[model samples]
Target: MTALRTGVTALAVLLAIVLQAALLPHVGWRGVVPNLCLLVVVAGALTRGAHFGVVLGFCAGLALDLAPPADHLAGRWALALMAVGLVAGLVRRDERPTIPVVLVTAAVASFVGASVFGLLGVVTGDPGVAVTDVLLAVVAGVAGDLIVAPLVLLPLMVLLTRFEPQRRLA
Candidate 1:
């Protein structure tokens, strides 16, 4: 079951990355693409725990950093998404969260992820990020993530929920 869950998780992350790379860029809102990969990590953390979220975040971010069309330094996103996972996981509860809670969490995660990525770029002396309107990008990215979160999170939550340990009826 663990192996199966791991395999499914890997496939899901890979699919998210593929979609993020291919479909999302073309349909971006206000020059910011929705981050399906970050959503996946959030779902994992919400369903599983912080540890899983952190690991998945790192792996997914690394893939995004290395994916084709990537023109920025590697590890920036890895660190950023890892931070997202950590924050989301810290906010997770044993029971399911309400819609508002989930949305707020997604917004926070989106903000943190984008901010960290942009900050890392600035720290690393990336010329593109130095001049980009980071505040606008962050706002747009958060809005985009919020807009797409329900669509992405619902299915992902269903898939990830299967990985939870079954409750024993006493």
Candidate 2:
């Protein structure tokens, strides 16, 4: 059962990554793309727990790093996303799993992810991106994640509940 759950979660994360990289760019608002990967990581963290969240975050970040239109320092994304996952998992401790929590976690995780990426860029002396660009992207990603969280979370919750009714019964 746990293996099945992990497989499903991994598939979901891969789908989210592909969609974010392929479809989201075309649907960008004012040049800001939503961080769908972050949403998936947060959702995974909330549902699964800290260790799974960290592993998922690392894999997702690695995928993002390897995808086309790459960024500098490959491992930066991996580390930043790991932090986001850990933080989101921590959030799950106090917050109930709901749309509100999903939205809030997405927003917060977006900010933290972008900030960590930006700081790493600076630390690496990469000339990097502009601070304003990073901040704007974070804000836009947060808004986009908040708007999309309920749509994704609702279906995910339904599917998970169907597969693991005991989870909901508890």
Candidate 3:
């Protein structure tokens, strides 16, 4: 990737995380905060490729894990988001995803990402994380993601396209 691409991606990821941890908490549905970091990785992977997605996912997930007020295990989200990025990257690299596809992708990514994190929490002896809670989170998280994905992912994808001219889809 070009320097421009790298800078833009980093900035975009930072902005998404900031907004996700700050603004979305109050504005989102009760009990569910939007996962903008996951959306960023998904957008990067879908528009860029699998490797890009995986790397971004790990970085963003680590950032989230280390962010303040995080109570869960450090690697839980990292592993989950890595899985999300891997799956997102597996989509045909040449495909220019449409709005509906992006929405569906967000939903799937959010569900998978949250599920993996919750499962890991369970395995790690977190008494508060139950299957019922996981299911609820998946439901609420997917709903919130679908609503926010278009608003956030599209612009981020546009930035990625512009920053990495050669990677822009037809």
**Number of the top-ranking candidate, with TM-score as the measure:** 1
lDDT of 3 by residue, 36-137 (tens): 889988988888778888888888888889887787889888889888998888875455677787778778888889999988988998989888988898
Q: Please report how far candidate 1 places residue 106 from its true position, in Å.
A: 0.7
TM-score of candidate 3 to 2 decimals: 0.92
Stronger candidate by lDDT (2 vs 3): 3
- Where model 1 places Cα greater than 4 Å from the true spot, the runs are 92-94, 168-170
Instruction: Judge candidate 1 at residue 98 and give its lDDT.
Output: 84
What C-alpha lDDT does candidate 1 achieve relative to the native structure?
Answer: 0.87
How many backbone clashes does every candidate have? 0, 0, 0
Winner by TM-score between candidate 3 and candidate 2: 3
Number of clashing residue pairs, candidate 3: 0
Model 1 clash pairs are none
Error of 1 at 97 (Å): 1.0
Superposition error at 82 for model 2 (Å):
0.8
Residue lDDT tens for model 1, 1-170: 88888888888889988998789888997557999999998888777878988998999899889988887888989999999999999884756788888889989999999999988888888877653577778889899999999999878888888877787745
> Which tens-of-lDDT digit does each residue in 1-170 have in candidate 2?
76787778778877887888789889889867777777778777777667877888898888777777775779888888898888887874654576676677777887888788777887787775777777777777778877887888667755644444254323
Query: Candidates ranked by lDDT, best first?
Result: 1, 3, 2
Q: Write down the TM-score of every candidate.
A: 0.93, 0.85, 0.92
